[model samples]
Each structure stands twice: as C-alpha cells, then as structure tokens.
Target chain A: MKGISHFLAGVAAATFVPGVVESAAQGSYLIVLGGFFGLLPDTLDFKFARYFEHHINIDPDPANLDPQIIANAVAVEIDRAAETQRAVRVQLHNIPLGPNRWRQYRIRFDAERNEVVITIGPIVNAALAPLDESGQRVARAKTKAKIDYTYDGEMTADIWNGPSFAFVPKAHGVEVQFLPWHRAWSHSFTLAALLGLITGVLFGSLQAGLVAFLGMSAHVVEDQLGYLGSNLFWPITKGRSAGARLLHSGDAIPNFLAVWTALALILFNLDRFSAPVQNRDPLLTPWVYLGTTLIMPALILIGVYAWERRKDHVRREVAQQADIVAELKETEV
Target chain B: MLSVIPSIYLAAPDETSAFIVLPGQKWLLERRGYEAAILTGIGSLCGVIVLVLLSPFLTEVARTLRIILSPHFGWILATVTLFMLMSEWPKGGDRGPTNWARFRAAWSQLAAGLLTFFLSGLLGLILMYRSFAPVPVAFVNLLPAFIGLFAIPMVLTNLIMGTRVPLQHVGGSIDVSPALLLRGTFAGSLGGLFAAFFPVVTGGIGSFLAGHATAQRDERTFIISQGTSKLVYYAGGLLLFFLPGLQLARGGLASMVSTIYTPGTPQLYYTAVAALAVSGAVSFLLLIPYARFSVRFLARLDYRTVNLGTLIVIVALLLLTTGLSGLLIAIPATAIGLIPSFYGTRRMNCLGVLLLPITLNMAGVGPDIARLLGLA
Candidate 1:
C-alpha cells in the first residue's frame, strides 16, 4: 500500500467511532488521532528506521593497498563476465581529503559487468612517497595492488568476518550487502503494541491507545502482503517472515482501491456527522448508497484487476518467446 | 498568498509548458539560438493580443455557462472529469521499450490530469465548504496541496532518485526571420485564444491542438509557440480579470484578485494590462540570469540536500497555514501524486481529484453522493 492509503485507512477508522463517542468532548480529535496513528508504522520504518540502519563498509588500508589495483582487477572480472555473456557491473567512488589521505574509496560490483566510477578530488594519493635507504624520498609513482580473484561461482564472498560481503539476488540484480539490520525490531508487532499501550496510558483512554495499536498493526500487516516481510513479533521472531507475494508497493490498482475505499468511507462518515437535516430527507436512498458508494467502486476495482491480469498474461507470453529466441541464438553461437 | 509565489516553480514545467514541449523541442530551441528566443517573444506578444481581443466574447460565454449550468452544472462537470480520469488509467505493465509501452505511457497522462483535479476538489470541499462542518475553516489550502503533490514530490524524487537533469547553456544573440516570427506568433496566439475561451482547457491542450492544426513540422517553431502559449495562459488570463465588459476570472491569481475587487472600468483594465506588460518584460530579463544561476547552483550543490531543505520548508509552511488537518490532507495527496511517476503514467491524472467532484456537483449527483456518504 502507498503512504496515502495507510493514512486514509487510519482516517477511515477514526470515522467509524460511535456517534455518541464522537459527540463527546475531544471525540472528533481522538478519531483524527487514529488516522494519524495509522500512518505511524510505515512512518517509523521509512522516516526514522531507514536512516538509523547502516550499510556495510568495506574499508581497506590505503597505506598498503592502492585502490587502482582493485579497480583494475574488478574491471578485468567485469570484462570476463561480459565475454561469457554473463551480466555484471562495478561502481567505484574515490573521495580525497588531502594529498596522501582519501576520505573514501568504494567499489560496487553488480551481476552484469557494467562499471560506474564516482570520483571526488583525485584517485591516487600524490603526497605518499617511499623513503630510500639514504633517507632520501623516492618520487611518487603509480603502483598496482594485487587482489585475489579466485573464488567459487557463488555470489557470496565472506573472505573475512569483520568485513563480510553477502550478495543477495534482487529483482534488478544482486544486492551486495555490508549490513544486516533490515526489517528488524523497528518493524515489529511487539513494538507497535508497546507504543499503543504507552499512548493509551499517557492519554488516559484505552480506545485512543487501541487506535494507535491498530494503526501500527495495519502497516505491519500491509507490508507482509509484499515480498519483503516485516519482523512481526520482533525479539521472538529473529528474522523476517516470507511475505504473501500478491502485490508490490508500486502496483497501482491495489493502492488506488485502498485509497478510494478509505476516502469513500470517510466521506460517508463525514456526511452522517455533518448533515443532520439531510439525514431526515437523505439525497441518497439505501439502494442508491449501495449502488454508488459500494457497487460502483467495487466494479471499477474488479475491472482494473481483470485488465491487469490480462496484461500480465500477455507480458509472460512475450517473455517466453524472447527466452526461446535467446536460447536459439546461444546455441548458434 | 506568499506561498503562491513558489508555486510558479512548480507550475512552470507542468502548467506552463503543459508537457507539450518535449526534449526534442527544447534541443531545437537551444540549437536555433537567438531565432528561437525572438520567435518566442513575438509569439507571446501575439498570444497576449489574441487573448485581449477575445476576452469580451469569452466572458459573455462563461457568464452564460454559469447561469445555465448554475447549481447542477458543477456536479455534472465533476462527473465528466472523473470519467476522463478513469479513461486515462494506464493499462499495460512493464513491457520493456515496445511501441505498446510507449502508447500506454502516452495514454496514462489522463490519469494524472484526473488525480490532480480530484485532489484539488477534495481539499477545497473539506477546507472551504462551510456547510459540511461544525466549524468551517475558510483558509485556502491549495498552496499546501500543490506543495505536497507537485513541488515536494518533484524535489524529493530528484534527491532520492539521484537523477540529474543536465542543463544546457542557453545564450547568444537571437536572430529570427520575420516570416518565422509571424507564423509562430499567429499559431501560438490562436492556441492561447482557444484556451482562454474554453473552461478546463489548459494552454498545453490549446498549443497541442494548434501544433497539429498548423502542421508545425519544425521543433524550434513548436517550442517558440508553446512559450508564447504559456505567457498568454498566465499573463493574459490575469489581464482578462480586469476587462470591464468581461469581468472574467480565468486563472488562480485572477480568481484571487476578483474575490478582493470587482472589475468594471476601462481605466482599471488598462492599468492591469500595463502592469502585465511591465511585469512580462521584467520577467524576461530576469529569466536568463536566473536560469544561469540555477544551472550553476544545481551543479555545485548536492541535490539531496537541496531537495531535503525544500521538503522541510514545505512542511513548515503547511503547518503554519493549514496546521494538522492540512498536513493530513498532504499525506494522501502526496501518495496520489506519486502514482503517476511510480506507475510511469501521466501526471495529469491527478487533476481528476477536483474535476470528479466538481463535475459531479454540476450533474446534481454530488449532493446525493455526499448524502449517501454522510458528508452532505
């Protein structure tokens, strides 16, 4: 679900508060609070948690290892992969602080042997000079550093424990991982419950706290619908559970339906609360309400779903044809 | 009101250019040098003249429309707007770079147009319609809405996506042939005239129609014509507000002005026209330096930081003006806004937000729909 869908779901929940409670002091505000709470789960993961998580760093001693050698070795491997028609790529970054010291030099290798280099300042440390036996400094020169390339075909390269590299296959390519804390405690159901409890205690209203819990839980559950599942139970669940792969975050129809449904419900609630006079002679009869609010939106959603499935079927057919053609070409080669 | 000024940056590419002037058009403009600029200027002047000439007739038509449509027209229009949005929904998935993909991409523009229209209406009704709420908040929430939907998203995408648009140098003496200038001006002005006359028709649509009508083969000519069309849509639209006979309120700025003061005199109309002319000239002069400065600034600064700052500013402004409710509205608006870019559809679908509601009102179904939903 998109961000707005989550927020709307929260708003829709608030609209469902009993009419009597809504008339009570700060009732409307509390209901609105539910909507805000609905956004809390994703908000925690995207706005706060993502930043706290760190990427794994692969730092090599600049004094002994020239980054150029690594760059060349990676380039060689990329070329080899390309020659064999295997997809691979490499990304290089070099940031210089001074003549001899560099802020950072990072290289990223992808499944397809494509190389992308980002450089800040200069590549080599010009200030570093080797001393001769007579205490005279030798001139700065370019030197190649040797890197071991021999490894099993497996993508994972855990050469050392301190700077372990894990290559995980992704939709686009293999993601070279340096850090492990993704979809952890922050995306946990336990945390959401705790937060809800804390909020309830502070606000002196169990209902308010429940709204908070519902909001957070809604987000966690929605995320579980995607391929990347959340750590539902946090400490008890050590790893993310495999998700029910029905849709992606980017899928348009599901997101649209969620938002539309939420909006429709919210509007219905708003009409009920705001127009007491109209309620006596309501413009929308029960039948009309059933047709417009529920039936129409549902029909549109169903239509979109069917259309998408047909499109997907067509896409799969094309992909299979392309695969067959590629196999034939490889055999010819 | 102050926040409206920043909206120009958002409006420039989307509302002003209307996505008619493609990359190819831009490249042609750059390649053509001074000729393109001169032609653009002439074309804009022509557009202004056409708009000025057409104001009285269009205003009368608009007045008649309001009277005839009155009460139920808003609903009917709103419904039509929604249908337009639905019709434009992108159908195909990621099919690589096939012709079908391109066709889907082109058709998806309607989706954006619909979404934007819908969002604007939703926000307006919630914030401005006093009849529906116990405590009606009369504050104009459009600025914040636009900020969240268009401005913030644009800046954030630039930052997070790390996609840098290379800015080409636009400098040198301009030299346009008189024939080219005349042709471009006529075509552009005609487009502007049509846009001014029609409700819900933007400059982009007008220019696009004109481009086809005139069979404009040259990209440079198309770019120059679009430039003129934008000026007419904005400046000429403002000028129309002051026309004594017309009393027209065409664009946002003009609509705002009309709320404060009614136009009834030729003297005031002339004054407004003069102001527009002076402002237009000053803006033209400022544009070159601003463009150059922006290019350098973008190149030197980290786009991520720039975008982050922009996002913070928008949030602060939203909080200051519309407060919590406005922020809440922004959350949904942003998500809807992202749909176009995310799905690789046209951003125009977002316009359906306003169009759907407004059209529904005109059709007399809006109130019933509202009643059914308990919002009436």
Candidate 2:
C-alpha cells in the first residue's frame, strides 16, 4: 500500500473512534493524529531508518563498466548470508557519466539456474531514455548457495539511487528481499501500541491513543494484502513474515480499492454523525450505499485488474519499457 | 452562478494543478497527441457525467463535510505540507570524491528542494501579509507570481537547452479499451472528488493521492486518470457552490463568485449540471482540432522561438497587470522555481509557496510569522 492509502485508512479509522468525528466536525484537531500516526511507519523507514541501515555499498565505476565484477560481488553477498546464517544488505550505486547521463544495469536472481543475472545496459539520459543502443552486455555468475527469492521482477539500477536488497539465510536457502530496509521495526503493531501509549499519556485521552494504534494497525493490515508483509510484532519477529500475496504493493486496482473504500467509510461516518438528524434527510442505508458505490465498483475493478494481471511479467515491463524520467516528470507527486 | 467552465479553466495546468501537461506533452511528442488529448477529453466527460449524476446526493455530503472539516483545516493543511516535503528521496548523489562529498551532494539536492519550497513559501507569506498588486486586480494578483514560479523556468530551460517539441503524429483513433477507460474514469473521479471536497487540496494533489492509492502505472491509464481528476476537481468543486441548500463554496471559481452573488436554488444547481455537460462536450469537440493545430505549429517553428514568444507575452502581461512590481516578485520566484531543475528535485516542491503560507494562516500562526518577518 502507498502512503496516501495508509493516510486515508488512518483517517477512516479515526472516524470510527467514538466522539472523534463529532469533535472533528466541531473544530477539534484530535482526529488529525490518526493520519499522522498512520503514515508514521513509512515516514520512519523512508526518512530516518533508510539512512541508518548499514549497507554493503556496491558502487560501479563508469570507467571500468564491467558486468562480471558486479555479478560476482552480488553472488558473494548471497553466499556469505547462507554460509554464516546471517542477513546481508547490499546497496547498488548507479554509474554516472557526466550531466544527466548514466550507464544503466539490471540485476535479477535466477533461481532456476542458481545464478545472479547482471546486464550492463545502454547509456541513458536523465529520462532513462537510452542515448545509444551500444554499451550493453550480460554476465552471469554461479552462486554457491541456491537462492530462495520470492520477487520475480528485475531490479534495474538505472536512476532513483537504484533499489536496495537483503539476503537472509533461511533453512531452505538464502532468501532474497527487495527494499530490505522497509517494513521492518517501523511497521509493527508493538511500536504502534507503544506510540499509542505515549500519546495517551501525553494527551490524557484514551481516544487519542486508540486513534494512533488503530491508524497504524490499518497500515500494517493493508500492507499484509501485498507481496511483502510488515513485521507485525517488530523485535519479537525475527524476520519479515510472508504476506497473503494477493497483490503487488504498486498495483493500481488494489490501491484504488483501498482508497475508495476508506473514503466511503469516512463519508458515511461524517454524514451519519456530523449532520443533525432534524435538518438532514436520512443518509442512505449504510449497506445499500456501500454496496452500490464501494463494493460493486471494487468487485468490477478487481475483476478487471486480476484479468489484466494474467500477463503480469512484472507489469509486462511497462516501467522498463517507458522512458523513466518522462514518467517521473508527469507524475511529480 | 453554477458555471463549470471556471473550474475547468482552473483545472488547466496552472499554479495549483495542471497534472495533464507532462503526459500530454509526451503524447504530443510521440505524435499521438491527438488521440491522447481526445481520450483525456473523453475521460473528463465521464468525470462530468459522474458529477452530474451524483449532484443530488452530493448536496448532503458537501454540507456535512464542511461542518466536519471546518475546524481541522489547519493541521490537515499542515500534514499535506509535511508529506509533500518529507516524501522526496535523493534522486542522485551516489558519487563524489569522498563520503562527506557524497553525503553533501545527495543532501544538496534534498536541501535544494527544501529550500525551493521554503523560499516559495516565504514569497507566499509576503504576498499574503502585504499586497503590491492593488485591490481592484486582487483576483488576478497571484497570476504574475504563478507565471513566474511555474512558467518562466521551463521557458528558460527550453531556451538554454535548445529543447524542441518533437513532431507529432495526428493519429485518427486512440488505442483505448472500454476496460482501461473505466479504470481511468474510476481512479480519476476518486481523485477529482477528493480534491473538490477537501479544502486547500487542489486537483494536482487530488490526482497525486488518487494515482498513488490506485497505483496507476500504465502510461495511457495514468494520462486519462489525470485528465478526469482535473476536470472533476475543477468542475465538481464549482458545482458544489451551486448545490442549492448545501451551497458550500469551494475552489477559485466559487470563492470569486461568492463575492458578487449567492446561489440558493435547485433550479440553478440543475442548470449548472446541464451547462457542465454541454460545455464539456464543446471542450472535447475543440480539443481534437486544437491538438492538430498545435502539431502543425510545432512542426514548423523552432520550439526555442515559441518559448521566447511565450516569455515575452508572459512578462508583457505581468507588467501590464501588476506594473513593474509584479516583475520584481517574478524575478525571485523564477529563481526559486529553477532550484528543482538544477538540483535534481521534484518540481512539485514549488507548491511550497501556496502550501506553506496557507498552512501557517490556517494554523493561526500567519500573523505571528508575518510580524516576525517584519511584513506586518
């Protein structure tokens, strides 16, 4: 789930807390606490934790431009994780070639061949549009350990500081993880409750504490629907628990559904509790309005998304195929 | 009283919004501008239809929302401002001579983005506390500043880089499926409605929230959704102001119109709906030819010249409306606007101008800040 989804989920959750919405309608800022906490988990990871994580940095030299070196470097990390029964986090630095120019590369784990596949791709401009078709080659290095990675998509080290990964030693093999720093201690129910307790103590309002707990809990639960589940109990849980695997974290339909459903819930609560009964016509029956507006649309969109996803070869390589900078500029938010 | 065109115009790529521009620019470059623009227009039509169909029910929703959100607007605005600032990660800066260099380089871009936002926000604060544009032209006072912040930098960049608009293909038909359009419509409407309903939330932010929540990745779906969201936000926001008993004034159109007239009738509300549908059709009808004309024009002229002409026209207009004082405001704004491009930051940070000052005001600290800055 994205930031806005969690934010809205927190807001919707706040609406359900007794007296929150009524006070909100009457000029109280207590409910805003829900959104702040709801988004707090991700905010912590991306803003603070991302920097603090001790990563084995792999910065490729533009002058050298060798794929084999990169492949072997990654293979060593995987082997180390498995042999030592420890987790290893690796950060791949992109090769820069002057102003708005970069030598791009792709790294994908091959579970079938038991190799790390590395492809040094074309020299791309600011938009990740290839400057020329030249300067491209592929290299594969055999890994000592059989990798057990769930992610099928290739992590392209083009722009955006590339993607980060962690290799965890599992009983079966070395498990590969994308964005290893994310969804760790921050996205935890334990942390949520602790923060909630702090808020309650500070504000001396049980309502405030509940809003924080539930708002953060909503983010964790929503994330469970995605490919990667959050560490619900934080330090109590050794590693990230596997998700329900229902949808990709970046999938459009589920994100939309989450936002829409949350919104409908918010609206229903607002209309029901905020408006005076004497001045208002009866708000639509909750089930009827929700069924017509939210549930029906959710079903249709889900069906469409699922059907389209049948050809899901990593979103059919849309991001890779399209110009990266072009896409980023258009969707600046 | 129930005009939708104001919202529609407001929705156009401008200070607060204009999510359609970059996608539209890409399509125009690909020669599919015709189809893309047409599809977006259609997407907006769907948005209008949704707005009109839901007009009756929305009346109650609007009234209830105003009551619920009136008190909490301050922190809500503050949260959005905070999110907008915090989310942007370093685009690049992995390289430099040393660790400190690398750290500085990366943080530099981040700092530039933050600085851009804060600087623009300072400008916003100045404008809010003191006015140089005069009272009669108050409605258009922000126009010059907007043109400076958003428009001038791009024109200058194009001129400096010698960037050209690629020759476009005037394709006859758009490659769109009913399913895709429906998805776009659904996502876009969600965004537009969010923007229209929420105070201080613009169509761009709405589209962004909707896009993120919906995870629209496909190029076409993203474009169509943005188009729809913009229309729904602008027009839908205006429509709310005319909702008879509800009459919750929102958006620029509603704000401006409220000064002169007040609307309180079902007939007026319904008339606005009818007008929306009709005008939306007319806008779409013109989009096809307009896109085609643009393709032809770009094919002939040097894009540099086009940008040059644009700068001249913009500066001329600024001078005419705001006198020399507007140009003074523009100079600093243009400089602040360019920070994102030079520092490898998100241009969206430029929105800090409006978001920062407004958030301060809503939070009841605007006057204090103004006094602290000696603007008061």
Candidate 3:
C-alpha cells in the first residue's frame, strides 16, 4: 500500500512539473494554468481524506482538524494496550480557506493495526469542497457485488502519495526549520529517482531521469511558490517552509519568466528588435525576455538589500537595549 | 529765428488768441478750442505709450553706447545704475560717488533700466496734464511733485547723455564725434550739453534743479560736496507725494476701487496707460537720432566750453516750458503718476526696506485719511 501510494504520488508530481514550466514559457495565459495545475494534487489529497473519514466508523468531526491534536491523540491511542474499540477515519473535510494557515490531510489512524498514516497537501490548497456522493461510483445488481459504501467502518483505503507531501512541514505550525522546504525538493527527489529507474527499464535511463526530475522538481517548485511555503528539509526535520507575503502565489523565477514572455510579445510586434530570435516563435522577442529577466532579479536584489540594511539597523538598536538591561542587572548584583 | 518764419502769420493770428495760446511757444499759438482739445488728447495718448516703452530702451541704448565708446565705461554704467537703483531709499552715508562707488558699480544696469522707465512715466504725466487747456487748479496746487517727476527723467537722461563718450573711432583713422560738442565754446561743456532741452530726454527737471543749484552759487559744483540747498532737496523729496496717483493706478485694492472714481471711467485709465506707453516709444525713436547726431557734433568741438553754452541755452528753454506753463496742472499730474515708480524702485533694489515702511504707511495710513474724509 505504501509503495502504491508513493507511486501514485510520483505520477501526480510528474504531471505538474512540465505543466508549470510550459505554462511559464507561454506567458500570462498559461500562468493561470500553472496556478490551477500546481494546486490540483494538493486539493485531491484532502478529498481522499474526506472520503476516508466518511467510510470509517469513527465520528470524526470535520471541524476538529488541528494537526498537533491529531498527533497527540494518535500517540496516546497507539501507546495504550487496551482493546481499544477505536474507529478511525482518514479524512480531508472540505473547509473554506480563510486568512490563516491551513492544512488538508489524507490521515489514517488505526488502533488494532497500531499505525498512523497521514499525508498533507500544500498549505494553499486546504479549502472546503462540497460533500456530495455523486463523485463516487457504485455498481448495483452486478454479478460481482462490490462493497461500495463504508460509512460506518474504519477506513482501509490506501491514500495516494504525491510529490507535494515531500515538503509538507512536520506536523505543521512549528518554526524549527530556518528556510522553507518548498525551495528544494524533498520526497519528490526520491520519487523522481525511483520513477527514473522504472522509466529506465521501459525507456532509457537518461530520458527517464530527465522526465522524472523535471516533473518532480516542478511540483516542488510550485508548492514552494505559494505563501504557505513547503517542507524542503522533509524527512530530516519535516518542519520547514519559507516565503513572505510578497509574490506568494508563485515562485519568483517562474513569475519573472512569465512576465518576460508577455513583454517579449509586446516588443516583437513593434518591430524594434534588438536580440536574435531563439526559435522561430514569431511571438518571441529575445530582448524583452532577456531584459526583463535580467532586470527583475537586480531590482528584487536591491529591494532585499535595502530591507536587510533597515533590519540590521533595527537589530543593532535591539542589541543596545539588551546590553543596557544586562548592565543594569550587573549593577543590581 | 523768429524773423526767419513769415512775420505775416504771427501778425494775422488776432482772432483766436484766447484759445490758440499755449504757455511755451514752439510754433502756432492760436487755434480753436476743439482743435486744441483733439490735438492735445491725441498727443497725450501718444506721449504715454512712448514714455512707458522707449524709456527702458533709451536707457539700454545709453549703456550700450558707453560700453562701445569708453574705457572703464562698464564700471561707470554700473555705478550709475546702482546709484539710481539705490537712490530712492537713501541709507545714511556720505552722499558722493566716492562713498557709494563700490555699490554703484555693482548693479548699475538694472537700476538704469528701472529708473529710466520711472523718470519717463513721471514726465509723460506732467506733459499730459500740462497739455490740457486752462490747466486744472488742483494740479496747480500739487505743482512741486508734478514738476519734480517731469524734471527727474530729463535730468538723469541728460546726465547720462552728457557723460557719454561723444568721440569714437570709425574706420580706424577718423573720430566720429557728437555735433553738439563741436558747435561752439559753450556747446560741448558736459554740464551745459546735459542741460539742453533737445538733448536731455527725462523732462527738464534735473536741469532745472542743477540750474537752481548753479544760480545759488557762481558755478556748478559736485552735488554732494557743495550740497544741493535745503529748498532744492525738499523740492526733489516732494516727488514722493505723487505716490497716491500711481498707487491708485497699481498698488493695492484702493487702485482697483478708485476705478469707479477715476474721472473718465476704466476706458480713460486704459487711454492714460496707452498714451504713456506710446509717448515712451516715440521719445525713444526721437532720442536715438538726436543722441547719434549730438555724439558726432560734440566730437568735433574742443572739450573746454562749446557744449556748456549750448546746454545752458537748452536748460533756459526748458525753464520756460515748466515755469510759464501752469504748474497747477502739471505738478499734480506728475505726482499722481509717480506712485507706481516707487514700487518699481523698491523692486529694483537689493534691499527694499525703505519701500516696505512706505508701502505699509500707504496701505495702512492712506486709507485712514480716506475714512476720515468719508471717502472710504
């Protein structure tokens, strides 16, 4: 089940990586595609969780979804040796995304099995979806009867693991990690490496590795691009996310590239061509692409430099105050 | 010269002696009252325009001519311009070229332009008011200020003219000199040439003052060293009294408010302004040829005494124009005309502190008088 879940996760990651890159190169129209495609797997993870909760006998209230609480409860229940009449539901209850940190999990808590399996979607995707049975298919009066409904039993479904879970912060809402895990691929790297091996059996190692790497990296980058940040130090700390509110919806690199493509289209139409065409994409003007791409980084760097200077000044003043307090204490002694 | 014109015309003008006679005779004196009025009105209108425009131009021409013809002329021009610029608000200093020499040289050009327009405006008003038949008694009452304005521009232009380098090299060998300087022993004297009626353009006021000075003593001397007598000084200072007319024309709300009370309505105010501007321009045109001719004429004669006699004769002629002419009309007209000039003078100076007090007083105290009289 773990291997199958991990493979499904790899496949999902594979779909997103190329989509984001292609969209970025296509200019603004595809930027919308990139944003939607980037959040798809994350949203699916929560949907599976909701499905699990409904199938399980556990009357898990959808409103009670603090990761820490779940972690503590699972720790206590797992450690106990009683005939725990535990009912487990792994769910992703759909809830409206508000102005706060959010997480959607494909969570499974088992008492008899003594196992807790949980996977989280990107923080940006934790939002409510309508609870409807129309989405799930059921066969009636068939030769092979299928147990389609499990509304009063413990959930036994294997959750699909995607590359997005690679950077899901360790239990969420803890600041032990220095930088966002989203910046670097976590579980995505291993998944891509394994997928590359499988692809090498079918295709060639180089092509498979390139395709898998590209797919896995795109998923990681897209999740990181969102404001919630990603867990880049995944297996080690699982408590990493990075990014500020500014430019939160996408990675700076892709956003910069998308803007460059749009600008190139505009400049190309005007016929004031300065750079040689890379490909015969008549829409592609090289100067605008090169200029905007180069200029934006410099501008962002300058802004960062100024912010750091001001921050350093504030730190110095704070240190001075601390020194004064220390001296006062010394005198008191 | 009187006999050179047909004697029969002067003898035949017996019918309209009352209307035709003007105070100073230049040509025909006898004419109908209506003809006199139309001519005087047109002439006054023309005079005003010329005074406003040409005055500044003439001052520039003088500075340019000096720059071209003389050594250290720039310093002299600067000194004169600054002195004229600073003269209005006299700070306590020994009054002489030596004491104020440095300052005089500093801002001379700007001062010259300001003072020239100022002096010409005064003269235009005096000339306008005097042109009226049976000059008004109220103007006569304000004679000192009127004559002072009319007189100041003349004195300064002549002083400027008299001091010009009348001799300049033309084509390397020959000196082209002013004609007035060559005419006779008395014709080229700087003092006398400056005093001439035709030569000095700022009404004959300065000549009149200089003459007054000379009359008190045997010979003319430096104004600072010998000192203009108290009477002459007061007469010159009385020029300030004309500020009311100019103030009403331009200064504060009173000027705008006075539009209602001004005799002929707003049209008349415009007409008066237009006339002064026209006259200034015309005067400017007439003076250029005259200045050129005089420079060449003066170049021919010996420097000792030729120009002085001619200038003396000219000053004598101007005296006849102002003295016999009704000061009753000319004086007040000039005084009223000069108020705007004080504003001009104030703005031209580096420090305009003197105008500040005067402006406050005029804005403040002038209204109080109007209120006391219920004129407000």
Among all candidates shown, the one with the greatest DockQ: 2
Off by over 4 Å in 2: A201-205, A272-333, B1-22, B26-35, B56-61, B64-76, B93-107, B246-249, B253-268
Which is better, 1 or 2, measured by lDDT?
2
Measured against the true structure, the TM-scores of the candidates, in listed sequence, are 0.43, 0.86, 0.20
lDDT of 3 at B47: 26
What ranking of all candidate models by TM-score puts the best one first?
2, 1, 3
Evaluate model 2: give its TM-score: 0.86
Docking class of 1: incorrect
Instruction: Please give, for residues B1-376, the per-residue lDDT of candidate 2 as tens digits.
Output: 1122212211122211112234554444344555666667777888888887887778786766665555557766776666667556555455555556666766787889899999988988888778767777766766766877888987787677666445566676788777678778888888788788877788778776555544445667766787788889999989989988776677998998988999998889989999998988887777767667755765787766767898899899898888888888898889988876576666777787788888888766789999999999
True contacts kept of each: 0.00, 0.32, 0.00
Give lDDT per model, in order: 0.49, 0.73, 0.29
**Residue range with the least summed lDDT across 10 consecutive positions in model 1 chain B:** B1-10
Q: Give the lDDT of residue B349 in candidate 3.
A: 28
Candidate 3: list runs displaced more than 4 Å.
A1-187, A197-209, A222-288, A297-333, B1-376
User: For model 2 chain A, where is the 10-residue window of minimal lDDT?
Assistant: A316-325
Q: Supply candidate 3's per-residue lDDT for A231.
A: 46
Q: Cα deviation of B368 in candidate 1 (Å)?
A: 1.3
Better of 1 and 3 by TM-score: 1
